[model samples]
Target: MAMDADLVTAGVLVIGDEILSGRTKDKNVGFIADYLTQLGIDLKEVRIVADDTDAIVEAVNAMRACWTYLFTTGGIGPTHDDITADSVATAFGVRIDHDPRAVDILTRHYQAGELNEARMRMARVPFGADLIENKVSSAPGFRLENVHVMAGVPSVMQAMMDAIAPTLRTNSALLSETIDTGVGEGLVAEPLRIAQERHPEVVMGSYPYLRDGLFATKLVLRSREQDKLKAACEDIETMLADLKGQRQAQI
Candidate 1:
């Protein structure tokens, strides 16, 4: 789907073989959604790619080019397979090396002589990139242009998000209202379609659910313009009420 040009849109590139293999349960996507919703940034797309360098580079390049911002998670660690920083560097055509700022932070955290080669790998970052401080762990993430490289661990990723949030361009919050319609999709299908076509700016949807053994349909209306959303909601309620009265009279 096409993104709304009026909104600040973001894409998530999840890079890790473990996540695709179902070995690791990813917790970052939900965290990011809630975080972005609060900041008024629309998350338009999400992709999961393996730890392969080529795949990571291609996904990063596409997402960074298309979206206002791209947040990447996983593969930034001390292991041989941790290649996100270097792959992102390849995508941006920049030199990758051990950044001293990151080194100093990790150095201070590790005990004397405890910062081995594996641990030191965390210091590697792309040229011209700025460090994203990790309050959960001393190791840092990096920001290169529109892409923000973060940790795979949920806590560390959250810390990185908090660090870079204030720097991002945000939009006004998307407003939403949910009203229960004591009917099913069959009863409101035509009206819902008409409402959606009439108000293209609003996101109108019906969700079916069971409450205390009784089924009902919930009308969820969303829009950045509060007045427009309210009007669409009122129209839907009136349509449903008219249908109810007609049914009672026919019975």
Candidate 2:
């Protein structure tokens, strides 16, 4: 039997001192959120921890136990600070080994002179982990159980996501419909709240923006079931139309 869409949840763990210390702005959070939403996976929580092994281990343990799926970005490079693989291994009580499949990809891309020890470190995977292909670079990321370890580099991480996304079970794509109201959120909050209560299955949100010295609000209705999203959108539209009619009638 199919279950409710809200029953599934996922989490993301970003591993980097650069992000924690404000040295680097993280771009993967929004990208992963959007990607997971497309797969009908609700991104429930996100944790950004420094490159410390204990921090990474703690986050991996907690998120893995809670969420249906856990994705981690960064700390997978060959540099000294890249310790995510080992940290994950320790967390899972497993061993880290050089994955042959990853090595094969690296070997094909590089000559003997170019294949150095540092680059080979990227091939290491936690015990019983599966390699995630890096289409942009020879170095590969990995997946263990429900946790997916991906690179911090956007291009490489995107390629890894493409390779692994098809293998996982996906629910229905989340559908969202939006309408721009030429009114502030405060003006429409009451009606929107009523609309939301009427369609509890639909996730409704209002984003206010300033455009051309005027305030406007974008009302969005999101849901995994397309029919529910459409129905909710119609209700919201009807309410907004009534509000407009009232204003015109007064004028």
Candidate 3:
């Protein structure tokens, strides 16, 4: 955690009907979250919409308006069903056309006359967007305002992130500490709540786990303020120890 870091936040839009129907498992959301977090940008929301135009447009506009940045994956490829480019254009109220730079990149990647009309569809971009290089496939993604459009494929999306990472804005990355207690959440809830009350600025949560028929509670504390986060973690540690000791005494 850094003292002067601003809370830059982002949202992710996963567009595809295949994903909703369970035909295509999503592989981009987690990567986007981890990537953004590494850049100190908090991922506040993630929306998965169908390939339908209205759905994509509405979700994109809504998330883009609210977050510092919005990332979209899927539906940007070259096919009849790939309506993401058009939907994004409609959302921004801008024209969509074959971007020459994108076309040139594709041209070089494909042999003469091999780059057909369908493949050229990858070159289409919304007006006013800057191309995001795709080192893996040459068909670049684009960045329009706060919205970044990337491919659905995991490797390609990862490459696009690398290409665009330098341009993204960031803030203080969250810091987290976890303490495990060999007891159930019910045994620690009250004391944990009291500790959280003492540190309002930190986020505190308890997760219960069952292993080998034994229950345990994992307390995770997160905060951008390192000092406060450290103090809260310390308090939780003491609370857990005292609680465990008391339980042992009663046995």
Q: Which is the winner by lDDT between candidate 1 and candidate 3?
A: 1
Candidate lDDT (C-alpha), each: 0.92, 0.88, 0.90
Q: Write the per-residue lDDT of candidate 2 for residues 1-251, one digit (tens) a residue.
A: 23465466789999999998898899999998988888777888999999899999999999999888899999999888899999999999999988888888888999878989888888888889988878898688899999999999998888888998887776677788888988888878988999888888888899999999989899988887888788888887888889889988999
Poorest stretch of ten by lDDT in candidate 1: 1-10
User: In model 3, what is the error at residue 184, expressed in angstroms?
Assistant: 0.8
Model 3 quality (TM-score): 0.94
- How does candidate 3 score on lDDT? 0.90
Candidates 1 and 3 compared by TM-score, better number? 1
List pairs with backbone clashes in candidate 3.
none
lDDT of 1 by residue, 115-208 (tens): 9999999999999999998999889999999999999999999999999999999999889999888887788789899888878889888999
Checking candidate 1 for backbone clashes, the offending pairs are none
User: Model 3, residue 199: displacement in angstroms?
Assistant: 1.2
- Rank by TM-score, highest first: 1, 3, 2
Candidate 1 Cα deviation (angstroms), residue 54: 1.5
Error of 1 at 212 (Å): 4.4
Instruction: State which candidate, 2 or 3, has the greater TM-score.
Output: 3
RMSD of 2: 2.8
40-140 per-residue lDDT for model 3 (tens digits): 88888999999899999999999998888999999989899999999999999999999999988998999998999999999999999999999998899
Winning model by TM-score: 1
